[model samples]
Target: MVFDDKNADQAQSLREKMSGVRNGLKVITLASGKGGVGKSSITVNLAIALAQLGIRVLVMDADFGLANIDVMLGVQTKHNLTHFLRGERRLDEIVHIGYDGVRFISGGSGMMELLRMNEGQLSKVMHGLTKLDMPIDYILCDAGAGINDNLISMILASSETIIVTTTEPTAILDAYALIKTIVKRDNLHPLHVIMNRAESKKEADHVLDGFSEVLAKHLQKEVNRLGHITLDPEVPRSIKRQTPIMISAPNTSFARDIRSIARELLELPPQKEPGNVFSRLFSGLRK
Candidate 1:
């Protein structure tokens, strides 16, 4: 909420001096209450879009159950978060390059493994992250779908969370449930939404009207609707080709929607990234 220390400003300035790093390492998680809503796909392309804008970005596949981000990007990973947890690799070693110069880490398939991590290991991991030669501007975490202790903690610790959902009745209901749970825990949490796989802007807005109404009346929270992504034939094809839309089909409507979202995100006021990330993460479980 305030300057962490006197050197906070100086440290931030130094990070900006890096090749193309943005001012702060803004942490964002793109999540959905149900899978198959295209959450990971949006995360992958969104990170690349930000990178294309000259921002040093790192997208983490925080699912902890699936490692599809790499598969979608058509890249293989020699190391992941599991290796770091087992003391087999450093944090930086787990990061791999993706399209448009974006960086990424694949979260291994064991969410609970993090709780067993000790303070010493946590310190080492933190050092590994903060000491990167080229600092990161944003850490976009593709948090796994569904509600759980780990997911809630991740959403709480992030600077902002974009809930990706479709216009399907079930998808909308699940998204509302997710929002209710999050607001129940922290009503003041900053929330946003991305309408994906929509038929048109009219349909997306029709859904938002009822959705945001429920939040304002019952939960007392208003969410920002970033924009909607039209159902483009190019999306599935791009996925099959293992190329991000931003690179393969930049002229498609899908890529245009992503670029618009990236611009909207960049305009947000930067949040202060505190030191000792793991401490803040595990501490949430204690509450």
Candidate 2:
């Protein structure tokens, strides 16, 4: 397989930067096989839930083409990731604090540029990320849907990848494709699956069971079922109000499920304690 030298250099520099950071901030990249799978909402609520547990969390709206985490949280952004990428603003300056103590950085129109960055540009971006001074326990990356070079790169860079999907057959197929692509590339990082908009617990279990069986039988990859979110009327109401269900309707089924998922993630073995994130990511990328 042919490799791009610039991409390689960029990866190496990112790995070095990650290894140099001493803090154990868990970087979680939430991705999906297709759009309209509720990936961003899960990311927003999960970050808020984690923050409620007293864990400092930051969300990066890396969806690029269709970024909306800021809008969802009702926090208007004066500046976004574009400003930081252009060296016009620092990461702290662009990070917008939102409801429930969760912070976010908007992707704006600069997401495509982020994906297509060459080695030098990518290195600068990585350096800026490492320079962030927040005492963060988690950094949730809301990556764009599907398998793209940018999506795959960010997935590999993160300490964990959370794959979100609904019970839809197409969505499941796409999720499988996404997992297959990642495992074929590198399977060192842990993968977590979440079923959103599930009608019932039994249905969610059945869907994930079939999905898991396919991976184990064909791809030889294992994924942890984080949990599922039931379809709730309050979810849409909360979204329309620009509030998270965890904050708006805390007692609702959707909110409770998200909180449960947050606890599960916290209970998982932390990747940051093992080594520098960059070292671990680089090792996976180079494989």
Q: RMSDs, each prediction?
A: 14.4, 11.5
Query: What tens-digit string does per-residue lDDT give for candidate 2 at 164-241?
Result: 999999999999989987786666668999999999999999999999999999989999899899888887788899
Tens-digit lDDT track of model 1 for 176-286: 888887776567778999999989989888888888898789888999988889898998998899888888988788988888888888874333335467879888878
| Model 2 lDDT at residue 151 | 68
Alpha-carbon TM-score of each model against the true structure: 0.79, 0.86
**Residue 77, model 1, lDDT:** 79
List where candidate 1 sits over 4 angstroms from the true fold: 1-23, 108-133, 268-287
Model 2 ranges with Cα > 4 A deviation: 1-13, 109-123, 268-287
* C-alpha lDDT of residue 146 in model 2: 66
Candidate 1 minimal-lDDT segment of 10 residues? 1-10
